[model samples]
Target: MTSVSQRPAPTPRQLTRTSDRLSFIYLERCTVHREANAITAQDAEGTTHIPSATIGTLLLGPGTRVTHQAMSVLGETGAAVCWVGEHGVRYYASGRALSRSSALMEAQARQWANPRQRLAVARDMYRMRFPDEDPTSLTRQELLGREGRRVKDCYRAQAARTGVPWRGRRYSPGDFTAGDTVNQSITAAAQCMYGIAHAVVTSLACSPALGFVHSGHELSFVLDIADLYKTEIGIPLAFDIAAESDEDPGPRTRRALRDRINEISLLNRCVDDIKRLLIPEATARAAAETDRDVVTLQTDGGHHIASGINYDDHENATW
Candidate 1:
């Protein structure tokens, strides 16, 4: 076995890309420790090895204990670690991004900082969700109205297709068991989607609070990203799981959704979609600079200068 000190931290290129990683892995009643480049989960059964670099997010459910070395390896591999409730019902905390660059975050901020641009991105998101409909001329109220109607339609359509009974969405906060089978599954699926989105958002080094459609919350951007797949993936899958059986809908939906997400390569598409929404005009350039570590100092008139250089001088400089 290789000693811990002998293993060098993996570089950005050496680590698995977020788009190619597992959406999120939930572990409970296990002790997580590091062994070389992989994490070992020790439970009553035995020890299972998981490649740390391939994890987009690690959700530590109840009764999960993690060692410092495990965290170190996870951090080096740029995996987001989230402390979540059972079956990821409640989210408590998250780890850092995999990226060293802030270009995407800058692009997101630039689009969000302007009212017209923000509205345009919001409209674009609406368009992505409903490609057949045009939302370019709709006001925020109209967009919200349309979104509500469309989601309701999706619920009804999925119910009809699955032959499941639907009485609208009835979710009682803090009580997962309060809702019917479909509702419980929907909530579970949504939570899992949130986990996946949060991992992607953080991995891309984008601010989770800056959002085009949703606002005023730390995870507003996460919610916005997750909703992009609700009607298409989460809702339909939830209804399908509910149709199959009502037993343990939360865990069942999570497992099924994980499989579905991987099947559709949702992470890759999600990364591309977010880039298109926030920085459509600069996707190529953004992709090229995603892994760069260069930093620059801001100058007047939208200019950037080298960070290590001293700008103060007796001679007049235009900088």
Candidate 2:
């Protein structure tokens, strides 16, 4: 019997999340209907066509009814669907992210499986939140305490800056009218942050349930990633909008968040941060690959192949 040569594995498709297609649209009280290759929102104001190809995330807040066809189109275009409550209090569910790559997911699991390695990853995330504080020697509880103090300080600082009366963070899930203006604004901005964070996390092919700091919940990882930006993006915007005393803070906060995100290039930053925070081994592995000596083959136009596999560039096979 003749021996069989192994067939090469087919290249995995790329679900590229573009930097240009980064608008995290927030919609409420509208009907999302699929209109032939496009998505549109039908409400009292009339039909407004949405550019689905470039939409990163669509926050379907209260009263937003999305048709099955619209969801199918969104899934096809790789746009994340986030179902949130009014003022973003209830993060009920989210649709799938577009990435088909499993490399990052495997790396994240391997790291978390080991006790020492898991702690190291946690410290790395903590460092991102507190660059000044050395997380190298801190335990998990210590990190939690520090983060708690930091969040309190952020609320106080923002309240002082905006001159908004702050009683504290008090809210019942799905009860948007229960909280004061400041609380409502904070909740609104935070929902936007969570929605954007989910898009970035899913784009990287990371697990939302596997988180370093926040754990044991569906949105554990989403919350962990979102917290990294509370001081910089979330709290500041809430304070600014509340300070303005806008007659309608909910819509205004959402608009301001979208603008602020674009202005600061927050989507790109979120994507980069997720990779750096979760799969740092990728950097080291890349360095190791570059350090190895490449072997040249006379066939295939004198192909010079590296020594290891690169999931990011599967077509340029190495291993």
Candidate 3:
């Protein structure tokens, strides 16, 4: 006689709400503390509790101090940590990806390893920026040259639209004061893009080192993905902010970019674009599996997390 059996349902963890999944938290001069499931920032004024579940990435800006306990909690929450500088934001470190599977990363590596596939991916990216045109036959150098020309034109157009002075894009990594307000604004906008790109890439369990367009850097893929949206959003955003009065453009630019990001629902768009670019077939399968709710949930000390990198929103996603 055959017997029928049913598996027990997975228990949901009692994690805190993220309050609409606010993506970025920029802090300075405030000490970070973790109590229970909440993260807080303390200063002379008072204490501000940051909801860890909704925090995508925490920026440790200048003059901020963080304790080991706080770091431990953030790791558990699966939040990405970035150490920042003036012009550009370099990724200092991060916790483990919410997804436990490396299938997406492996697929990325496979495509990146093949020269033809790499070029094809590059063409796909170019097409993303220039959807009306075809770039399938273009060589890598030709593609790069065309992209550069498009960016120059984009800068000029945005400058004209926003009434900002065009003094060319000049930026020295170490020299923060190297350019005008426009330059500063552009730098701030680009930094935000890079951070978002890093978050999405890591969240998908992909390696930022295996880049199709850029190479030989830790954030090569970050640069590649971030550059894809430069014309569509970043350039116009910087130009608009630069058009504002010339006082303190850095914070203003980042805040405005954040607003635009929210307005256009950019996070979900990013996840979709990354899936479309990396592994379409596998992504489709994952989406199907997720729809069927066949995911494997893992519990680390009774804290539940989704088991694989996601195409759609993860069921037990950490953050």
Candidate 4:
């Protein structure tokens, strides 16, 4: 048997793609450890082995304990690990991304650095959420107003459809039970969406804090991406779950949302949407196709030269 240190780490191309993996696997009250490349979850009933490479995100809910070997395999396999609260309502921490390339990260930074470009991206985000409406000329205030109205309308519509009593949205952080069954479902779904979106964003190596629309928060970009599907997916599904039964709405919503995510191939769509929003279509395609682990030296006038060769004799060389 090979030692852990002697095991070869899989390259980016060797690992499973974010778009083709399991949406998420939520576990609680289990002791997670590793056996070869598979992570085993042991509980009172029995132990179950999960292929580490095929998992998009591992949501460790309350009472779940993970060993270092499990985490090592998960990181090696490029599977995101998220420590979430009960019913996956709160997100505490996350693991590294799968991507080895910085193409998308650079594009996000370039678009976020300029005020005009940032606003343009914000408008584009709004357009994505509401494809039928045009937002090219809307200011930030107007955009916020429109978003608020649309969300309110969605709530009313879902309520009407589900026949769940409609009251104003009420939610307080750290208090999952503060709201009614519908609101709890919505909150649960939103948190799950955040976890999923966060996994995809990080898998693509995009900065979660550098959001075009949301600002100041560490998960601003994650929030922005998750909101893109709220009205269409999260809200409606939350209502459906609540309408079914209020018992364990949080867990119920999470399971239902996972099914919906898989049914719609949401992970694939999210990866494509993120790339489209940050980079040109041609560049996005090129970046996705590039599997090289390359390094370069940046010189004056935005030029990049091949790395590893010293230019000590040249006076014009900056490095």
Candidate 5:
């Protein structure tokens, strides 16, 4: 009988490297085609080329299609491509290479349901990122001051002009009634925030479900992040756009909302603050290993796990 010497587990540094290698390819307005078993893409610049095999997730907007050749190429590349249409609809196709990651994702799905754990994780994240700030302190008064009040007033006046319900207070997910104009506006805003948060999470190589503060439910972190904006940015902006015209918001409204959100410096700052807090803790958890086992655990954030991981290096790297 041959005895096996155990291999050393991967360090935290290795896990971070894996995460950095992950990339998200978002096709906001591009065309994909396949012909005779070759895949090609045409972008706004009129440039045509084949996508890199390294691309992990390929997201397409409405009306995007996969041709026979393109499908073959994608199949060979073993990437997961997602097509998103109007009203939050989605379709996806995955290749064989994604099987391993997909399995790891399933393992992750099992650990997301405890709210207390999520809050603890959120506190840890806050402590890690904002060591100087007190978690119990609500800075709404100091932060909002007079300027925040003005923005709120502006939002209310705009809402009134559109004949929409002016709640005269901050909006919450539970506030919207079903099938009303206000409800539609709320849903749209929430959806936009969801998309933005998803994009941000993908960009940061973090898992959206296994989140701090929001817990293990699907879309929890998204809900948390969206909550941060729905009242501050989304509500005001939605009202403003509606006030501009009595017409229903179509593509123009979508474009306007996107542009307005993009222009808000404060919104970007808030997201940056949240990201800085969340990523390190998740990374540290990812690098931990048990005993001598060199098990590779897949996290929602797409991090790999090894044994006895030290978070010091990962923390240092972020700084």
Candidate 6:
């Protein structure tokens, strides 16, 4: 008999056989159709039709709409659907197919329970996109440390530039007391971080519910990662944006803010580095696990799999 450890690792076929299933559909001003047993999509007023054989998840923006035929096709495909509302809120549809549900759930659970594993997976993902960075020496703790310092410094600089009082108080890992001006800054900073984290989670094809370091609650693990960036990135950016313009931020200000974020060299570099370090670690952790239980499969199959994996509803913190 083959020893469990000596057995050939699960091939894609085996992984899929035991995997929870899911797919995503992103609708950013695009229309979808089913033709010749394939899904075809086109942008509004655009001629190019993108075709997909299977869809595990569906993502939509506020203005996105689905025709009856499109819904029928998706249901037939047995894909889970996720959408972002006009307010940037997120929602998900239950998967109709067992295969899709198993795959998605497994991926999501792994995402939530282990930050190190998540970071490892993120690292691999970034490496695939940017091969120049060496991943062996990089770690999540290092990234978080660098980011934490940057956030503090950025906040201070922005406060000075904007003439906003920098409260001497250092923010701890908890909710801010009400009626404090410093609290306002903290809240703004947190919100910006949350947005970025949400973007990262969405891009990574992982469910935000499955978090690593953070306790599972209303705020996502992605949100927690985003929170980590608030002081370093969000606070300073918010201050700079508020200082540069005399008028309240409208559409133009929002666009400027986004552009500013994109142009941030240090922040972008850190994010890329962190992704490189995290993705592979997470993937490896998932690969090492032997458990086949769906719940364990979800929780134990990613990097940082051994620690900080709890789902407590009371862990919610407001900033």
lDDT of each: 0.91, 0.76, 0.76, 0.91, 0.47, 0.45
Per-structure clash totals for the candidates: 0, 0, 1, 0, 7, 51
- TM-score of every model versus the real structure: 0.95, 0.81, 0.83, 0.96, 0.47, 0.40
Candidate 1 per-residue lDDT, tens place, 123-222, comes to 9999999999999899999999999999999999998999999998998877889999999999999999999999999998999999999999999999
lDDT preference between candidates 2 and 5, better one: 2
Our model 5 lands, by Cα RMSD against the true structure, at: 12.0
Ranking by TM-score: 4, 1, 3, 2, 5, 6
Residue pairs in steric clash, candidate 1?
none
Single out the weakest 10-residue window by summed lDDT for candidate 5: 14-23
RMSD of each: 1.9, 9.2, 10.0, 1.7, 12.0, 14.6
Of the pair 1 and 5, which is ahead by TM-score? 1
Which is the winner by TM-score between candidate 1 and candidate 2?
A: 1
List the lowest-lDDT window of 10 residues for candidate 6: 15-24
**lDDT for each residue of candidate 4 in 149-214, tens digit (9 for 90 to 100):** 999999999999989998989998889999999999999999989999999999988999999999
Measure candidate 4: CA RMSD: 1.7
Error of 3 at 285 (Å): 2.6
Off by over 4 Å in 4: 281-285, 289-291, 313-319
lDDT of 2 by residue, 1-319 (tens): 4211232321213233535566588788999998765799999989999877678888888899998878877777678888887666677788876666565676778777788888888888878877888989988899888888988998999989878988889766768767888888888888788888888778656888888778788778889889888987888898899999947777788899899889988887777776676567556664233222234323255454544544465657544
Worst 10 residues of 1 by lDDT: 310-319
